[model samples]
Target chain A: MNDLARTIEALLFIAPEPLEVATIQDITGEGPDGIAGALEEVRGRHGPDTGLELAEVAGGWALRTRGDLAAACDALRARPREDRLSPAALETLAVVAYLEPVTRREIGRLRGVDVDSTVSSLLDRGLIEEADRPHAGPTTYRTTTAFLERFGLARRGDLPTLERFELTGPEAGALRARLEHADLIAEAETGDA
Target chain B: MRGTNPAEGRAGDAGNLGGVPARDASAALTQEVEIDLFQGPFDLLLTLLLRDEVDLLELPLADLVEEAVTPATDERWEIDAASQLVLLLAAIADLKGRRMLGEEVEDEPDADALAMREALVGRLVAYAPFQRAALWLADRLRAAERPRYRRVPPGTATPVPVHDDPARLSAAIDRMVVAPPAPSLAHMGVVRRPLPELLVRLRDSLARLREVSFDRIVADCDRLEEALTLLAALELVRRGEAELRQDVPFGDILITGTRA
Candidate 1:
């Protein structure tokens, strides 16, 4: 059991991206059942109560600092203060991040605001770039390597939970809750677990 | 009595004739009834506010409600009605505190509202930059265009069609669109060739052969699929059907039939 834990920890530490159970199995040469058990044990050892915990993100698992401790991590790293994202930029970024490889026209329609400029800023800041455009009029944009680097992510798949930054005013929260509930149902149908 | 009765009857007739016609009444009803301006409630509201030129800092909610229901503003405009209304609603909400409490209420705008306004302004400001970038990109894209079907040069062998008939080939291409073939491992796999054995056979074959151009041995084989042709050459060397010589720089290979 100790050996399994050590092996799992080592694999997680050196992994380029988050590891799935199947990936862990491949690396450790362990059976699925054994890997699943080991992962569960590791997760149990690092509960939410602790400074570090296991998080499931983008259909894979990674060891992450607790949400509450994010500020501390930021301080410890002495990371430069980032410019506050404007609502438009945030909205545009969210749309691009979630439905990535999306075109400017589609994003504009979604936000009810022209996104050409927002996309330019994002591109200029190396947060987004023109992905190959389909045979369509407008070219598509996708998040960039710098976006991941700025956010301390190895890839786009390392985005934190969408729930964290959801609009939560009275009217917005009510609508969001219903939408989230529907999302939960959908997730259950197609969840990785 | 006869004169009085006629005068009274004339007055009654005049009053009855003064009533509106049924068609005109229906028309009036239709004209007065308000239709929702746009699909999005928010965009419709913004349009109303913008049309009225109402300052965001002095939003008149009651007047807005009245204007929203007015039939005069129900006509479809150039911009999407829904989006207009959404923008109006956002502006109104943003200015709600200011409008209701006076400008000197020692209040700052809602952080989100201020952020949104800044972003919108930023987008407007960056329009020129986006246009410049887009124009540059468009020129680059135009310059990058290549001929769809490059003509095969004369004297060069026409490559064998992967699929024979054009119609069948097009259909196969369409099927590929729907379902792309998975990458095959055939190209990635390592092939073991005993170089020492090959060299020994080459020496043995050369002992009994006369010099020939290197091209003569591979003349019939496809140049692109070099692996298969090289394997065949190795096999020929092993069987004493070909020989390799160091006598020439580029034209070093020779072939001889065992019987010859």
Candidate 2:
């Protein structure tokens, strides 16, 4: 392969995050047009049908395993259910997740119990962090991406609605899957969903 | 001490006071007096009960009346006296209830005592939302309070021209947007082409024309597929079959007339 193609392949393989045109240029010492042309070539060679496909996500390019291969990847990386949080922890997490930029004082008042230790644990686990609270004496806390990953959420908005608490685990999961499929169908039909 | 007859002293005082009622005179005296006895309702009740030495089960109302009649201080004592009197009345009622019960009469303390504590808890509960609302209000107020002055420093870097007014600006914004004047092609390094057909096409194109427009040669291609194939062919040409122009904007050229 040409040096440009080889450089593009190396970038896709080693990039910690999705690669942008600017980043590719910086790495290959190429201009915007050169990098754009080279990426187009790389993408054309590896289409969606390939084992590894170039995907544009979050405003950048990445070489991702095809969507069909996700189940297999999940099977390989999946851990036992023993690490799941207890009911109390989940409840605390739900409140914090929903009302973030909330404080321990506010949470304690709502739950009718002091949550200092629980908040500390969440912070230690990197599931939540202390966010800025303007003028208030209390320091606000917010959920992190690790929290989303742990909960299998694409983003915070992917969190189950408050109404979902009435449903059983499998029922909720099935509902979530149906919603996701519907979203996919809609995105395919309209190009934006 | 100078009054030989108390009736004559009373008459002289009444005359000096301009026929004001005796009750009014006493009320005026109480108003002029000052006393720091009362703290709050509960504290005042406790103080009055202690002063009267009235048993909790048997409060002496007649003694309380006598105490109320006497003025205590020299100035501004009316407030203290009024609060004390109210407490005295409440204590009397409590004492009567205790007497009627004839035992320790362990009823719950006044709702006011517990009311204070309950109110404190309520305040604590309400504080969170209040603080959040306050923060939101403060943020809005701060945003509204910002000064609109544009005080550029004297020796600072001159402000760059915006595209909004191009007449005052020398350089075109479109030129800035489409960077670097021309695409830098030096980054594309020559390597071996894998496709046999692409190599044959390069030999064919090079033999037909001494030089060709690279973009035009791949213009018929729907996507980047043919362009990439053409790029691979050009790299092979660079390796052996043909030569490339090394100029300001390089284009593909054939050095040898032979078709591979």
The best candidate by lDDT is 2
Q: Model 1, range B140-167, lDDT digits (tens) per residue?
A: 3233221011122235565446447988
True contacts kept of each: 0.00, 0.00
Q: Which parts of model 2 have CA positions greater than 4 angstroms off?
A: A1-10, A18-62, A66-82, A109-114, A133-136, A148-193, B1-260
Evaluated on chain A only, model 1 obtains a TM-score of 0.59
Error of 2 at B218 (Å): 99
- Candidate 1, residues A40-137, lDDT tens digits: the string is 87888877677666655434566666656655666655544556555567567666776688888888866667778888888887878888865767
The superposed Cα distance between candidate 2 and the true structure at residue B250, in angstroms, equals: 96
lDDT of 2 by residue, B1-260 (tens): 33334344333443223332233322422322222432223333343443444354444555544455443332222343344444434445555555566734323335764475455445444333433433333343243222111123245566453434665353565656664667777657543344676667766777788665556666665444455765755666667766555354455432443344
Docking class of 1: incorrect
Report the CA-based lDDT of candidate 1 relative to the real structure.
0.51
> On a 0 to 1 TM-score scale, where does candidate 2 land against the true structure?
0.27
DockQ of 2: 0.01
